[model samples]
Target: MGRAFVYVILGGGVAAGYAALEFTRKGVSPGELCIISEEPVAPYERPALSKGFLLPESPARLPSFHTCVGANEERLTPKWYKEHGIELVLGTRVKSVDVRRKKLLTATGETISYKILLIATGARALKLEEFGVDGSEAENVCYLRDLADANGLVNVMQSCSSGNAVVIGGGYIGMECAASLAINKINVTLVFPEVHCMARLFTPKIASYYEEYYQSKGVKFVKGTVLTSFEFDSSGKVMAVNLRDGSQLPADLVVVGIGIRPNTSLFEGQLTLEKGGIKVNGKMQTSNDSVYAVGDVAAFPVKLFGETRRLEHVDSARKSAKHAVAAIMEPKKSGEFDYLPFFYSRVFGLSWQFYGDNVGEAVHFGDYSSGTFGAYWISKGHLVGSFLEGGTKEEYEAIAKATSLKPPVEDLAELGQQGLNFALTISKKPQPALPIEVSRSTSGLVLEKPVYAWHAAAGLVLTASIAGFAYWYGRRRRRW
Candidate 1:
């Protein structure tokens, strides 16, 4: 059987790791996989970097933590690929793709060839090019796509005062950024052109709940507003922000956490794109058989959503990468990765968790009136999604398993009972350990490990002797 081949994965993030894991699981040793990432540091979880880590200190506020990139903050070293025998190339950029030749030209004039390729280049924060910042005026505005962007924001926030902050969008990142600024006691004014927060993904009721929840905590919302340009002071600092409505607000610092677009310019027209993300089939494979894309880069079709949409969730990348890897290893066998979307955020001392599509008629419980409780999104009387505050790990895992099972269970009470019952009955699954291998190959060629057959035979003999002695002792005990 063919042993190994160079599986070159571009964009080292969650999806790439999944592909690597899948390859390893299929017995393609570590030396055969290679990953290239542009970022200097290895990939880390992007969610915690902005929300949990960016806590600010104040009397009304809780003790703050330094958030915004850097895996060291959480002691999460990027070791998945390295431990799996995958060659990782960091601080490198791929300039172009020669798909026919199966080669990638790096910006540094180096060409790397691959038998199978994966493009998980993901996406970059979409910048409002028409608008400008006050203090440091540059086209390269601040974004949180990578660690470097997070570092830059942290440095800028160090000297930020409690003046006025003009946030461009009311999306998740923008809202999270606004919440972070408010916690810092910064006079934050979130500008949203829409009537409600997260209107695209959330209903008016949920959006209103989030709006009122944050508003009570001193976050000011300037609804139905849009920014036209940025006004700076004599010192070249952003002094004020100008809106399209002939209105201007005094601003000391600004964070435009609007949204992001896929970074797929290198591929040009080689791959397919639906709404700017590369289009992938059910198996997480792209139009090109040998080329695959995952994470934020691939625009996948969600069966529940009934339409193709690009999911920016962290878990999506991880799962999709695994499916891609499985497909690469067993070309004849089909694999599918479809999981309900899950999102969580911590704001105002509340642990908020939402799962699946947050649309449809929501069957709610607990108390939104009390700013606490749980709610489930019900569509056609089917439990589609859930929104919760203050749920335990048991609840989290139960919900996950419920979503994974077949013959969709409709009874909420039964689901909860089953969830709790399973939690109590089953021992928690152990985390899988990384495989050990002496040598691996990258060109579809397997390298032999230095193991002597004599040593194995001696070990087998030792095992037999021990078993024989144990059997003899058992017989003596029976006779007694």
Candidate 2:
């Protein structure tokens, strides 16, 4: 004998929490919806684990960062789930799923069936052992992915205050963790195989600004090298790290942020895979009619780029999860998911936001030395992407609007001179408002301020366009 639900959401991460909230909003009946998660607690914002949660003082804890709160929406605590009659199967793992029968077999030997299922298994951090280096089993080594991992890192940080820490991997986790360590008065040396940090997103010039800031904080960098091995003390704590460049750095603790892989192993044979994630349609529906995928595990069509992408950012996870639920509940009204790639991070009094693709020639602007700078990417004479640091709320909205429109650029030199002015002008021009429902799904554009309708004649009379072109002609510099 077993229980069943009309809807079963797999995975208790950001996506699961958002999906649950969406279900409640769509009027899911009592006892009809259930969430199964290995995590004992309800979904909280996962990004906080790497940011506010790691603060040296007054650190953020669970219940303070739950789902929807990141988006400035209602916080969905476990109590919220219970009050809405949604079943919370916490600390439970689904051992197997039989799509044909629409049944999930839990590790506890209970069978829970569902008419429709949402897969949101998220991803797991890649361990150092996978790279042929063993010793991650040491007590001082840490990886931040879940609440438990965050707690463990805090414990390690407390014990290793004023000591040296080696951070492996220069990506998001490595950068953020290093900053946190430094804030805690720990000496940090960041190691990576790339010439500059955040190599995938930030151009060398942009990276330089951050590298300098970190250096100011006494964080040393080891580039173009990888970790060879780790030396452990008799107590099995990491004592030092060996690099490929024949240098050894003493370490009181180590943090590994190599990367992560989506939890798609369960659906390997059961679902079609693409780009290392479960392939889904514009509606976030998998190949199976009864199953849908969301979050980092779903490779769904990105209408903005006219391609399918498996985005690993928290914004993508939250929006995709909500979209999947909307498609499931309001099929007739729900349209295709139209998403614009958005990414942002905040560390050590620095914050930045990027919208759209990073392709094409990049034109940087602003005073880099002043901690206020930005860049725009032009592809085939159209502005396709924008990045800004230390921007106000209005400025961020301006860039988002400009990138979405993809305005044509006559000259690259003028764009650099105009810099933030170009986006500001575009934001003031009249433009069509996105549909109420559609605008909410897309990133970076929705705002409390009213959207202005386009004034064709006024747009043509704008002088910034001409000045921008001429400025670029006189000030064009070598691309970094």
Candidate 3:
């Protein structure tokens, strides 16, 4: 009976790990399900290592859940899959996939036949040298992706004294690394080619708030500048960064948090790619019939943005894994994963929470000077995105409600508690003027005090209902 079936899972990220669990629960006997992981170590939490693990000031370690064992470790690590009779081929790379033959060629010169295959090969960080930044002194410059990278950065941080550390790119990872270094009182200078941080994802207003937050934490920013070249000291360590402009930055430690690239060369002409990312529909299935991709590799669709953008967020990976599993099990009945992109980052003492994809213009609802407030993004007369800085549950709920619906445009002249009420109501009558753009014209404006929690809970439930309805509709469509 066991010989009648065999399923192979390639890649070792969250998608591969969890999808294996899903297969087991469906009564696929252990011998029938095989997981081949490229990484020698079992899967562990990746995000914590970069922020909490590297920071000496932080008491954070790997989470107790899903503990992984390294290959060298001789603890006879209790294998959850082994107990269930599942086979785990560790430290093995899938050299090639013969999809037509249902075969996987491994680096160890072994041929494994699979009745079904799931490709969760994920991505790797694009090396700085790949971007044409050549220097033998990349020894001091570090990139964060895995636990090894985090541990290496920790060592680099300890070896260097309080000198200037230059960070290239102002994306989420870059900003987080800068904040982590600053928490240890290390002088950090961040440079981004864009005028503002996270320009590709956030509005100018929300990016400004982040800029102010980083500045308040003593991080110096060199906006609108790109790294043109890297200079090294006599000791083979990076010492300076030349900018696209006629300026250069002195550096002791340089951290590159630019972005990540999907590892897709293994499936090179076999899969469809969008701008170099693997293109997958809502079900997380690749162009091929039996192959499905998830995590950083999958170019999934975002309903709010009306685009199939690839997201690298942790929650996105989790959701996409489930979607991929469903597609594999019930391809004829599997539903798509539709989740609003949610992200949270802590810089200094402030927690910035962003919900939904930021695709529209921003609307500021609170004061920015006090280092606390929230902003909403309205897209085509509907709430599409929001960011709350040092926000309360109620503020988050309001933003949740804003994103959950296509509420009519609000009158800027009538904003506040009354304005929120007015926003809830749709206006059939033609507006007196086409939507006007209102930016934060003033730098300093004393705002009113915070509202009660009752206001937030009410808004949260309403938004939850809308989400529930959408999920129900998607599931219903899958059944049909």
TM-scores for all candidates: the values are 0.74, 0.90, 0.78
Show the lowest summed lDDT stretch of 10 residues, model 1: 60-69
Cα lDDT listed for each candidate: 0.68, 0.91, 0.70
Model 3 lDDT per residue over 350-447, tens place: 77777775655666666668767666666555566667777666655566555544354565434433433333342222433433322221322111
| Ordered list by TM-score, greatest first | 2, 3, 1
lDDT, candidate 1, 1-480, per-residue tens:
122338888996656655665676788865877778897665556665567556665321111221111222222244545676777778998888877778888888878888899888988877677345343343223566666666666556666756666777898778888888788777888888999988766667767888887888788888897877777656567767788778888876777777888888977788877878888887777788889888888887665454567888777877777678877788678556565677777777767677666655555555567665565555544455666666677776655544322123367665444433432233254423533233323421112333566767888999999999999999999999
- Measured by C-alpha RMSD in angstroms, how accurate is candidate 3? 11.4
Best by TM-score: 2
Scored by lDDT, model 1 comes in at 0.68
Q: How close is candidate 3 to the true structure, as a TM-score?
A: 0.78
Residue lDDT tens for model 2, 356-450: 88988999999987888999998767787899999999999999988887777999999999999999998789865643222322342232233
Better of 1 and 3 by TM-score: 3
By lDDT: ranked, best first: 2, 3, 1
